[model samples]
Target: MEGFDFEKIEKWWVARVKDFFIGKPFKIKMDLSKSVRTLVRGVLSQAERRQKDAGGTAYVGAVMQHLVGAKLELFLDEALEHNGFSVADAPTKRNGDFQIENVVIHVTQTPTESLIQKCVDNLSSNLSPLIVTSHKGAISAENLADAENIADRIDVLEIEQFIATNILEISRFARESRKVTVEQLVEKYNAIIAAHETDPSLSLIIG
Candidate 1:
């Protein structure tokens, strides 16, 4: 007679499921962070206000497009995978953006994560989330340690490291993304040169 070993059965079952998905492709699920959504709204509102004051046109669609960095998030997942880390892409409609096996990864550019907590149960949630930012730099370890429910599981990723790690690949991306000619760059240089006339520090950037 065979012994009723529940732990053995569970391990075998889990192994089989994991094995089934080996080498299988995963999709990028839509897991947009709440903080990102709020920041978008704030920026759009500010833009609208500026436009209204200047008597210019306000386009909501354009604001939405700028806020959603779908491409950046996709690239992040690619980088993580390229480094031998299995990444579960963001879900299409889920509030939590992604899952790396059991761990969750949330992408955002906002400095605050309060809003993100509103969309999902962070503490009770089984998966952890990491905030990815392109602008916000040098996050405090304490602040990172304070994320609600996800404090223990949540962390932040800086864009500088992200770009630095994938600089070689990003060079190719930049080449593919070119839409303007040398003329455009020349004009930009001219403008920068004029700006530098008043402030020497403006010369910090050069082609």
Candidate 2:
């Protein structure tokens, strides 16, 4: 520690993230009785509790972002470009969280007026803007869009429902296949977390 340079260590870490190896795969065990949205919210609630315990520094948004990325990759059967949470934190002048074709997808824990403004910008560019957030955030996003007189232009989706509905559709509504679908989701999410986040605590366990 005395001899090592901090700047060199930081540089090494930056390189390490790109080559990070994913270890044992984590699987999501589905609760058959509960709706997919409910299960997804439960996972997020646990993440929120963990965030509160860790001095209240925000990681839930990171979790949501990566989860969305993982879901998209699994659903589309192709990888999506993933950036570290730090890059996501500094979103000034950025178009949206992720862009695919003509759609600009924004993922956030709490939707803000600034985010709505970005959606408006996306519209001006002839791109469809989609806001994916928590159920409460969905309402707030819609309200913000209304204030900007663009409520009908943008699409607002609850994160839980977005992922849950996808899972159901992917599994073809079969109870047995749902567990496997959820497992794939978790596996992809963990891979994204490992490659993008320095903190291993951000990784989701199979439980």
Among these predicted structures, which one has the highest TM-score?
2
**Residue pairs clashing, model 2:** none
Model 1 misses residue 84 by how many Å? 28
lDDT tens per residue, model 2, 1-207: 799899999988865653343222223436788788877887787677666645565767888888899999988999888887668524555578788889989999999988888888899999999999988899899999999999999999989888988999999999889878988888898889889888776777666
The CA lDDT of each predicted structure is: 0.37, 0.81
Q: State the lDDT of candidate 1 residue by residue for 1-207, as single tens digits.
A: 378998999988976765443312211122233222332334345444433543453322222222222233334433222110112223333434444555554444344445355324544556555555544322542264564444455566653344333432533434323212212322332343343233221111211
Q: Which ranges of candidate 1 are over 4 A from the true structure?
A: 1-93, 116-120, 134-150, 167-207
Model 2 global lDDT (CA atoms, 0 to 1)? 0.81
TM-score of each: 0.33, 0.82
Candidate 1, residue 170: CA error in Å?
9.2
